[model samples]
Target: MLDAGLLVPTAATGLYQRSGDFEDAVRAVEAWAGSLRLDAYPRRSLPPILPRADFLQTDYLRSFPDLAGIVSVFTGGDAEHRALLEDLDAGGNGSTVLEPAETVLSSAVCHSVYPTLDPAIPDEGLRLEASGFAFRHEPSLDPVRMQSFRMLEHVCVGTPAQAEAHRDVWLPRMAEGLGSLGLDVRIEAANDPFFGRVGRMLAANQQQASLKHELVVDIHDEKPTAIGSTNYHEDHFSVLFDLTTPDGNLAHSGCAAFGLERIALALLSRHGLEPGHWPTEVRRELG
Candidate 1:
């Protein structure tokens, strides 16, 4: 259960009345940030919603057009009423429209990250861990299926080896960090939320290439939910952001993100809401 705010509540919402596990998730992100050893992070603040056009270049819109937002502009009452009639008629006719209005709404936290993956990140590479509120206008109201949520991400810009090594190194670190709290975990292949024709082709190629992965955790006492993902965007962001390497070649990129509320659900579903009442060891670890 969730409030209208869609946050795990201390009173009426999901299992836990306290958010220790949620706090631990934050701790996990902070600890991961400490491990990066980078000097400065290019701080970013997301606009209410970026132009759908900017997102198109990232191919996020093309890949997952279903995730795109539909907009209709009206000149006056007649135009508005006509547009409404047309929409109703279209729906009744059961016809699909390959619509291209604005770009697409950002469905994730790092939507602004790529544009900042500067071409000149110097020799060592760029590393930053960020956390923020993210919105996606998908139709999900299950406490687990939230329309808005928090996302924490680590953006990496470097060579392919560095990019791969980045995830290979941190994936286990994150898993180990969570495991210390008694969670079971695994690293598995993943697929994207690609759109129609063009997106289908790109997603197929990405899947075959094994470019994306998720750190699936058995959050519940039963089956698991993907609490986190480690994705390699093999020069996709580099091209879009104009990110470059030592010789000024397009740099490869990757990101690891954590879905905050899902982890809370995991804790409650697995350990129960009265986690503080659990055994000393579990309580201590999460604390």
Candidate 2:
């Protein structure tokens, strides 16, 4: 049974305060990432705001408009502010003075890499590891479904075969790592939450191609939840960003992304609330 305030609720519905044990588990996961042979250089805290135009180019609006956290601010000048303040005193025009910002809150860390890449990549391709906060407008009280969350992301850009192979290598490796830590883990093909009727068709096609695979673990319920994912976006971002291989073919891109908060929650669920009493192997590896 879940305690009343284990995840201390904040003003936001989907964001919650994490306990100290949860923080330690997140640190352990980061250490595990360092053990991988991905040759990924670490970058921390990607820019919070993304260019609205850049986001639009990625077709995010078409797929996840409902989940986007668009940045809007008060554009009112001094006079407008006073009027708005007066209206606020009157309780009417609080929203009227706000205008959309040039940037939207970032949803994923992977999109940040595309803008920094060269027009063409070398035969060897590129790999990067980054951790950052991302925002989605999901309004759930479940600790696993945070509106603001962190992702430890590993991205690869190369030929189609190379990209897919990268995902294949990491998928099982991650599962094994998590399993050793005492979590029930498995890999399965998956699809994103797309929008509308056309999006349902796109999701089916995506599953048919087996482009996305998730490392799922039993978190809070009978049905398992995905703690990490390996995604292969075959030339989709490449074409959009003009990324190409040495041979001039559009580069294929893939990523392995770990949800830090979700993993921490899983650890607490598996190992009991107290970290000191956890299994010896689990404590040793994390220590």
Candidate 3:
């Protein structure tokens, strides 16, 4: 991509500035996905960072601390600033002078949405769709394993059956959607990269129960990339956020999330770098 002027690299390993063509491709993918559901789900816009308190409530720190990106800033006074500069000049790390901010970089696009949901959901449930930037601390040379990237998610909150149904419905739909773009796609059970030994157990249980499914496509010769996923969080967010269904039972939540950059990369990988030369049907679908 860098050779083709689609992605511009920086000093950071997993961070890069995308070219206009790259951005356009991402937008087209998002637009195509949005068109699949039309206006049935209300759209939401969210910031890249969320409150630390709310983040903590999600138990992400315990589950995926290695992938969490915390926002840090210099909150020091003038004297401290001078010392910090002097220290940096003396070959000290500037991060020493920074403190954790009130907010943390959001790891998932839907984390902020849960806090804003009504305490009691209606019988029909609540559905929302959002596209925003998400961050993860993992730094890698693989373009698909981006440290920061755009994510498009459709979130549902309601009873367990509704949540499961939401995930079930989107799993194949997303697979077919990506397949329509002329990429080989498949749906398979998957697990989150949980942390530690306990997390291993949790991951195993999660996979065993088929709680998460990914739409994967081959972007690299070595391994396939998960361009999208459907996860059914059974009463997880609802318990933390104090959400309940109309019958007073803890609500369940699920989300269908797509990595816009990954999809764009997949398109470039499969259809060549030139968008104009892509298949006519794919071009029309993107439009």
Highest TM-score against the true fold, candidate: 3
Off by over 4 Å in 1: 2-48, 70-105, 197-201, 278-287
Clashes of each: 4, 0, 0
User: Residue-wise lDDT of candidate 1 within 1-287, one digit each (tens)?
Assistant: 23422245443232233245455544544444344433566544454355566676776656665655544343346665666668777774312322444533457767666664556866877877666655555554356655556667777788888888877876777677656655677887878867777777877888789887776776445566787787887887787877888886888878877776666566555665545555566556555
* lDDT for each candidate structure: 0.64, 0.81, 0.90
Provide TM-scores for the models: 0.72, 0.92, 0.96
Which residue pairs clash in candidate 2? none
Q: Could you give candidate 3's per-residue lDDT for residues 14-123 as a string of tens digits?
A: 99999999998999998887776734879887899999999999999999999998878899999889989999999997787889899999999898899988788999
In model 3, what are the clashing residue pairs, if there are any?
Answer: none
Tell me the lDDT of model 1 at 37: 34
Provide the clash count, candidate 3: 0
Instruction: Give the worst 10-residue stretch by lDDT in candidate 2.
Output: 33-42
TM-score of 1: 0.72
Off by over 4 Å in 3: 220-222
Per-residue C-alpha lDDT of model 2 across residues 101-149, encoded as one tens digit per residue:
8888888878866866786787888777867778989899677888988
- Pairwise TM-score winner, candidates 1 and 3: 3
